[model samples]
Target: MRHIIAVLLENEAGALSRVAGLFSARGYNIESLTVAPTDDPTLSRMTLVTTGNDEIVEQIKKQLNKLIDTVKLLDLSEGPHIEREMMMVKVRAEREDREELKRLTDIFRAKIIDVTDTSYVIELTGASRKLDAFIDTLPGGAIIEVVRSGPTGIARGEKGLVL
Candidate 1:
């Protein structure tokens, strides 16, 4: 039972620390977390991924509500939502392999954001699985580095999770 929780909280120093502390103190685990200022400068939106059973997830929600900074919360996983992750991979791309790599990137609809004589940096965004598939397609020895922005999710339809 993986859950994607969206939280709206005051955008202030120590706010993120407190939320993370709560999870640690409770022995809960957060797989991924992404937070940034929202349109309202006074608040921030955080999307966190975690896995737990129904009871544990209920407890996590309750504990989150008890935080003073929490303005609103929603378990996006419980409703219709979309999740995406972005990744950048640097891979060997010598002349002999350049065309093949480019073709594969085109198939995945990824872009070569940077390139050198022997290496290429690709940018990709999609479901986590899709990104993993792309990585698997590349030769292991060709991968120089990889960076990912963990999955972020939002609910569908006109409704939004707000105070």
Candidate 2:
């Protein structure tokens, strides 16, 4: 099964490397990873998506909790949460095609962050499924480059996931 694990850790040098090394040493593949500072600058949060069996998932979580810098770990698969990812896509556009592209971008609720004679850079944020759908709708030969910030999520409601 696929699992999404959210880890809160101290904002210290090598912290991300350590978390990544753990997965590498165990031969576990991280499908997606997004890390950023939390409201409190002293800490950072990472959302990691991976696939594994029940036992393997449990073991990985256990080991992750053992990391000295880990402040919290939440298995979002078991909780109610709001998950989102952001993508910035640059696409080639001709003057005639620009209107159509803008229409599609508006439909996806994506913003044109930059525009030039030949290309437009669009910023989009939403659930992974929504982002994928938006990407699929682009015109053939339109995409010039893409940058994605992998999924970042937070549990919904007053209840917090950290323990």
Candidate 3:
């Protein structure tokens, strides 16, 4: 099963490296990871996506909790949560295809952040499925590049992870 694990850790050097090293040492795959400083400058929040069975997930949680930098940890997948990923796709938008590209952008509610005579850069944020759908609908051989921020999520309701 896929699990989205939220981790609060000390915003100090080597914190990220230690977490990544732990995963590498255990031979576990991380599908996506997003980390940034939270409201507190002394801490960072990491949203990690991984797939494994219940037993493996449990092991992952236990190992993570053992990290010295870990301040709090939560498996957001255990509760109601929202996930979003941001992507920037550059497409070959020639004169004849500009109209169609604009229409598609409007349909997806994506923004044309940059444009040139032969290309357009679009910015979009939404669920992973939605982003994939947008990419699937693009004209064949029109995509120049795509950059994704991966999935970051938060739990619903008033409760949250804090140090």
- Please name the candidate that would achieve the greatest lDDT relative to the true structure: 3
Per-candidate TM-score against the hidden true structure: 0.95, 0.94, 0.97
Q: Estimate, for each residue in 1-163, the C-alpha lDDT of model 1 and write its tens digit.
A: 9999999999999899998999999999899888999999999999999999999999999999899999999999999999999999999999778999999999999999999999999999997889999999997688999999988888999998776
Ordered from best to worst lDDT, the candidate numbers read 3, 1, 2
Give the C-alpha miss distance for residue 33 in model 1, angstroms. 0.4
TM-score-superior candidate, 1 or 3: 3
Candidate 3 has a TM-score of 0.97
Candidate that scores best on TM-score? 3
Cα RMSD (Å) per model?
A: 1.1, 1.3, 0.8
Q: Which residue pairs in model 3 clash with each other?
A: none
Determine which window of 10 residues in candidate 1 has minimal summed lDDT.
Answer: 154-163
State which candidate, 1 or 2, has the greater lDDT. Answer: 1
Q: Candidates' lDDT values, in order?
A: 0.93, 0.91, 0.94
Clashes of each: 0, 0, 0
Error of 3 at 19 (Å): 0.9
Model 1: residues with Cα > 4 Å off, grouped in runs? none
